[model samples]
Target: MTTAGLSWFTVDAVGAAAPPDTGPLLLDLGDFGSDRTELVGAKAANLARASYAGLPVLPGFVVTTHAAARVRRGEQLPEQALRTRWKQLSGNGTRALIVRSSSVAEDSATSSMAGRFDSVLDVRGWDGFLDAVRQVVGSADAVGSDAPIAVLVQPMSTAQLGGVLFGLDPLTGDRRRLFASVVAGLPEEIVSGAATGTSVVLSRGLGRALETVGPQVPGLTAGLRYRLAALARRTRSVFGSPQDMEWLVDADGVLRLLQSRPVTAAAVPPRHSRPLGTAPIAETFPDALSTLERDLWQRPLDEGIRAALELSGAASRAVLSRPLVHSFGGRLAVDLAAIGAAPGPRRSWLDLIDPRTGLRKLRAAWRIGRLRTAYPMLVEDLVDQVDEQ
Candidate 1:
């Protein structure tokens, strides 16, 4: 195993060993030389150490930076090639695989660069398995100029429920509070920022559940929290900021850490003092704007408008001040309006001015003006609201 890019070797043998060959040369975490290859990345190295100490971990292997560099140099070894590598690793068997990006720069002792790489799960067979690994490694190469890709190939363990756990709330970064999100099945969609489903927010009662589950496995809960806190502390130490981690629990209920990184650029800055008075109206408006934008992206205008109105607690049957269209620029204008509305309080007027309601208003005003071509008027009104604020 390699730790922090430092390579070490144990046995001098150079050839592949036969089956049931648990040789001394094959580095486990207990072996220092294995650290040279398997533990090159911080996250992988940490897991190796944890697993070596007899922690519950899914059976897996790591493709070290040395191997990755060899592949990058155009080496034709089938075992080293990602697509064919799995066949050699897994033999001829049908099993689920979890391919993750384990880069030196990611989940480092100091920095936690989150969501800067790729991870693919539930892959089956050698060809598709290799493609997923290649995709992850390639993504790192594309976005991470200086970081070398270290691949962690683990058998996909069963998971009845999986999500993320934070020692502190990600939104507020309050150390006094711990937050957890539990969802059924694998949490791929949620982690990818695609699925917005029911997420349970843990606080007092949930926090107790985290603690109660600890004693069943000695040091399990403590270790998890310790690792999480250590990651956060190290991240802040390295980058002068906090971090967000992605972790999951396997079918056996063993917590297997997947990735860690800094929070997104859009997270609110840490607050040091209490507010003196009510927050500005602009602050509440963003929520409304985000709701509208999300629905618009996920559904048609009519449906999106209805969803937004319902979410904003406004009647969807209210009339609009003007007509609207589905033109490219017009749709873009609505998007901009949604974006603007996201950071502030919802407006009853805006919520009520959906497609159906707007159509009614347009028909009522048909004698006064050409209602079919009045989308610009709605945009103008929204812009005016912002200007007035």
Candidate 2:
């Protein structure tokens, strides 16, 4: 039973539905051409747009907000629609998928809403997929925004490296340059800001960018970095504005564009205040310190930072608390008001940090002369640390 005025795009296995029009609910990522912000939300719409543009996006389906709107009104989803899509994914059920929130409010020109929603990753099987979708949809309702929530399901990228890219540098606001933060595995860790990643800036020409701060992304070749920069340049050109995007570089070195949003640039902050460990002493440290966590004043600064990371369940808390770290010039996240009081650093991680410059950075963070007194709230932990010595 197909309806007039709307051509439904359904995949293999799941057939058509009943007399009562449930509306064309599901859309394949590739089939999206016109803007469907009302249905798929901003992030999904952009992904769909890119997919339709012949970019190398993961094969996926968009669960339109129409289903969500029905759920909102206490109405039932068209069972036929759900089952067909389920078979498309779960029939053979070999590939694990990712279920991410796609909210209307996300990725607007005004707000990136980067970590505000929920995403269930590495989901396998039909039951798991359904649960993940419900979880994401429930997350949207709990979030309570004017925008309805939709879900995007795609095969998870086992990318050897992943993270974020800014079509233009947020620090210098240079359209000719591109900025990126890269992680060894999934982009989630870096994007959510719990851990920093290797930082790269591709300049004009071959995109000659400085390491500026943070450890450089490992295994990410110069050729790949240049390609990513070139992709960002194309994205900006297509959108007619600067774009900040999430990306994945699979083990095969295939690149995938996850999401892109508009960005505005601003003046660079103080080196100590910057996210990358760029202070003079940091020059000799390993790349991990700058990318993931920079140490505080304590011995075994890595231990302290890890203690800090352990406190949070995942990236959400890290993203909120990392007043000390700043993602490069993509997001206008310059001010970090609470990093002064965050807990300990990780072990094995702090050894690389330079003691002198690190002290200076800590002194700046604590806003005090005596380094011992800086962590007043953490005084008890400090005492134990000293006793360990």
Candidate 3:
């Protein structure tokens, strides 16, 4: 995510219901990061990183894991600090609060507890905030782990739009593409899949709506889409990997980050076969492309190549152009245009031998190229034997 200008709008919605400040220190959400996982839990820690990075995270206080343990033990509430914070927020016309679970085991490597945890919204006043905290502690066991669970208390946002953003394409596992499941208003229903949300894809830094799954989301300005994609890319960089982020835009058109986690599943191992549009490689048996397919096969270049077909520009129309060769059952099909192109990172020895051709040697070269394309290892063995002779 570039250092693009992403705005933060504080609306007329709810503010946090902080506990009485009379107790020992409770960490500010901005003070924590990924390193403070043991104290603040995963979500808070990530939010801390976002805040530290100058992201417009909503101001909030963490009811730390230790606080949760203390609360669960039935400690007496000082109650004054809560009133003081509420008074200050209410002074700014922010009256509502959002209480969320920040459990140690919730956003872990093994399990994320997606759609399983609870988030209390529109909580108001100190009593409501305390009740919400009690509720988060109450369901500790079902949320998992013996570790004490923390509750993240923040201002409730009334979103004009909201959605879940994936830093990379999910279906194809393409790192070059980012995808979002977005809704016009709040995303709670859409998140649960109770409603069909708009599907958005951000690829090569450009965003487009793939399809409108259901109801009209309405507020999809181009600027908003760009900001969303840029933010997704940036956070993915910060995490040093792909990220799964829950985000929202308020009625004022400002972006708010709710939560983010490393996309553990996104780190898929590279395929044995290479993808088209990229350069070819030497390995053949499992997932390699041959440098000499054109010679042995004698296939029509314009017909067999996908890239060559595109050379004619708008005039290059095709009935049903197919790839010269398939990779990984057609997932990484060869770009036909590039079949006879120059060598790249994974060059073939056939190219070195192709320029100086003789009749007998041509036949031999063709045979070698053909075999190299078909049985690369066998060709290598043959060449080794001839070199020995």
Clash count for candidate 2 is: 22
Candidate 3: Cα lDDT at 260: 87
The list of candidate 1 runs beyond 4 A from truth reads 1-39, 52-55, 77-91, 109-111, 197-206, 209-245, 252-255, 259-389
lDDT by candidate, in order shown: 0.50, 0.66, 0.64
Q: Is candidate 1 or candidate 3 better by TM-score?
A: 3
lDDT of 1 by residue, 227-336 (tens): 44454444344445444545556666666655444454444324531111112232422333355554454345435555544444333233122221122321222322
Candidate number with the higher TM-score (2 or 3): 2
User: Which candidate leads in TM-score?
Assistant: 2
Please list the residue runs of candidate 3 whose C-alpha ends up more than 4 Å from where it truly belongs after superposition.
1-25, 32-35, 89-94, 209-216, 266-389
TM-scores of all predicted structures: 0.50, 0.62, 0.61
Compute the lDDT for candidate 2. 0.66
Model 1: residue 111 alpha-carbon error in angstroms: 5.0
lDDT of 1: 0.50
Model 2 lDDT at residue 318: 44
Query: In model 3, which range of ten residues has the least summed lDDT?
Result: 1-10
